[model samples]
Target: MADYHSPTVIQPTIPSADMTALERLILGHIFDTEADGDGLYLFAEIGPSDSFELPVRDLRRAIAASADTESTVNAYISERIAALTDDDTHVEIDLSGMSWEFILQDIVRRSPTLDHVTAISAFTCTRMRPDGFGGMAVVITADAIRGKSTNDIVEDFLGDDAHDALYAGTHVLLRVREHAVKEQIAEAIGADPDLTSINPDAVTESDIRSACLDVVACSDLSEEQGAAEFRAAVAAIRAAERRDQAPG
Candidate 1:
């Protein structure tokens, strides 16, 4: 159990040996400037590849200009292959999901020609929104807002580092609770203040719901919505009840 789910939840990587012949070729282009890219170059040269129809430059530019390091390039390639196929044998960029961000970011910076814009448009998500959001914030990705006006707004609200803002807002790295809610939950759970102060596991759902009502009493958030959203915000910690991320 952990307060925040680690990046390992999705693994986020496909080993070089596991990649299809064409995928290995695209991966080599991403790390073209890296000294360690030599290994991948050899793999691409030795390949007898299958048919692949991709906007080769768009995908390549996405990786070359992306903020991610070499490792993430591999992960992006993995995600691309997984998205396009039911089984593991195929590898192709479906031009879907956040994968479009790579090409879109590049397009916005350059001329947004008809063909270029058409290539990455109409992307969709295959998964549900994470419960960590609590509807308090929307997952506004960098590509979703790619103009001068949008940049200014995002800089003001989320600060200049839009990628970092997207990461922080979506992930549940910490939990926030009002002091009143803390004390009320402690009393309801009947646990020693010192033992349970840092972790509030024993508190029943009724107690949590009651404490949330106390929070709503002091705020404009509707009693029902406030309690539910508050619970959602702290869902990670509640699931891992006694887990503390701090190093001993």
Candidate 2:
């Protein structure tokens, strides 16, 4: 077999210095698979194979190597699309519509894939690195390549399906923040008797702190005044933190 990484006098091969330049050639096809507005790219990347094993990590590395020609790269992408969606049961891939949410999910779920980021536009993936913390760390520098999740135009263009997975994470976060705020406010009131007298949590301790939650926002809907109390308590607690942090 001829070596593409090194050329003999008769057959010219890509030099090590220009390896990055070689990576740029297939970048268009990579991004195009995503931009085509179908889920083929993600499904192919993370979906299970015949034995239900995911080989996307290795598959991507092989395709991204300097030794791969453009035609072979295109064939690989095509084969992946077919392999992932061959069965009628896998129809969901086609319905997904090029979602960034799906892409991030695949990145987060897969174990072995490594992400290589570049000052080169995020849409253009370069050489594959052998190491990373995991998939999430791989894309830490890849915010620019974001699809419908971060791109306003793509989100709008893709409509409701695009926001589905993105907002699912957001919903979980809102719940966590609400729980944290309520707990913080309750701790403050319990610790301070003087503050307990305030039925409204929104009341200012000395005049600082933003409203966090009302009692009405919690399980005690009957305690209308509890809302004010909760807010005021939260404010007082934060105000205390600010005072401590202030310079003498």
Candidate 3:
């Protein structure tokens, strides 16, 4: 189990062919790039099917014309990754229970032959206060942050050779966690509900209530308001069942 962080960026080596199609798709999206000026080029690649190649002269021109080139590029990558989706996708990786070092080490271990890896960076888990629903957020940065401002650093790394690959991989990892949480919640309730599943590793106070509601709705044991009383009753029954099975 890894300590849950808000977001952490990792640079995974190219994985073997054993990875799922979705994983391959993400990896393909990442490592796409083209040579540009002075040994600089657009570094992001989404998949084998998606990529961008910019000439050095063109890159310089674009940066010169924009007041915030790095900001622009970072925003582009963020938007692009957010838009990615697959039909009936359901998988998630939860970092809340895993340590950062272990997670990174696992990634590296999983792809021992990959050589393009450069750097992996991440932000510590930060508490975010939403108007009504507050939770912790993990921030991940895969490329080097070189500029003075965060925006500049983003841009510089977005321009790295591995930017796209890093973005796609990180995005996939996030989705994996989301799906895993949903799955756990569904299993807990013995019924699939409309709300997304709660990542057990990062379960919030709200998640507990949400799960309780689902359990009440699905259990065969009650029919009233399905309030705390019902929950306690059902929980007690479950506890007794477990206790009965203990290896005595």
Candidate 4:
């Protein structure tokens, strides 16, 4: 073997507060893995003197450097994505149910292996309703070439049989808001309080009167008043639907 010499490079000292613990850890990992004999040098001289320096040898360093500033973080993550292994994986912490477009856009902007992404999936609890509290979790795994479209990849993963297994036994709860009288009538008639698919055509005035009388008997409402109210409610609903169907 001939003589081997690593390149000589100057490492800049960065302030501690500017970088997060996770960012520093990622940088150190990348530096140890990818840096040549001469450690990477951070380019921070153009900004204010108080700005921190970050020399990245690998993805970790790049991530740390970007975490120091908001605008540069995207660039840093993009570079790191390029430097990451073909098998790089990512996890998204989403407790706010952000739109898929936003999530994927951010991921693509920061990831080098965007095309190689093989699988993406969500993991979350039923309590974290995507429609309500906007809580969700996402993870992505990629192949070596990073050659797939994010939308297609995410759709396929979601469509997979394995993905469905995760949501097994999870009951979705839907809230229905109605007048207290309507709810009582539904309960008395053995109809679901939340059911909105009742066909008015399939029912008659007699049905409404009967339901109302039952509700009144079961509750505090006077039977005569309840029957009158039920008739009025049915007429109102029918009128509204007719108005909706009529041309504006």
User: Looking at model 1, which ten-residue stretch has the lowest summed lDDT?
Assistant: 4-13
lDDT by residue (1-248, candidate 1, tens digit) is: 21321110101122334333433455443222122332222122222123344554445444454434334334655565434433334335433333423422333233222222221111112344343211111122223432233334556666647767667756443333556565766575565545444546445444666666775576653576667778886996676765665456
**Model 2: residues >4 Å from true position, as ranges?**
1-28, 32-96, 111-218, 224-248
In model 3, the runs with Cα more than 4 Å from the true position are: 1-20, 30-42, 45-107, 114-116, 119-248
- When sorted by lDDT, best at the front, the candidate numbers are 4, 1, 3, 2
Displacement of residue 87 (Cα, Å) in model 1 is 14
Instruction: State the displacement of the C-alpha of residue 95, model 2, in Å, after optimal TM-score superposition.
Output: 9.7
| Candidate 1: segments with Cα more than 4 A from true spot | 1-91, 100-150, 154-217, 220-248
lDDT of 3 at 196: 50
Q: TM-score winner among the candidates?
A: 2
Alpha-carbon deviation at 31 in model 3, angstroms? 5.3
Against the true structure, whose lDDT is highest? 4
Candidate order (TM-score): 2, 1, 3, 4
For candidate 3, write residues 1-248 as lDDT tens digits: 22323222234433443232223223333334233332212123211123433333333333344423233232333343444354423323222332333222333334435323333223332344332221222222232122143445556787885777667633221112445556665576555455555444455434655666676576663343356567777999999999999998
Which residue pairs in model 1 clash with each other?
Answer: none
lDDT of 4 by residue, 1-248 (tens): 22222111112322334344444443343222233333323221111121223333443554555565443234434543565455555422221222222322343344443421122222223353443221122333221112244455667887886757988854433223234445555565566545656643345434556666675466643576668678978999999999999997
Looking at model 4, residue 213 earns an lDDT score of 67
| lDDT minimum window of 10 residues, candidate 3 | 39-48
**Residue-level lDDT for 239 in candidate 2:** 100
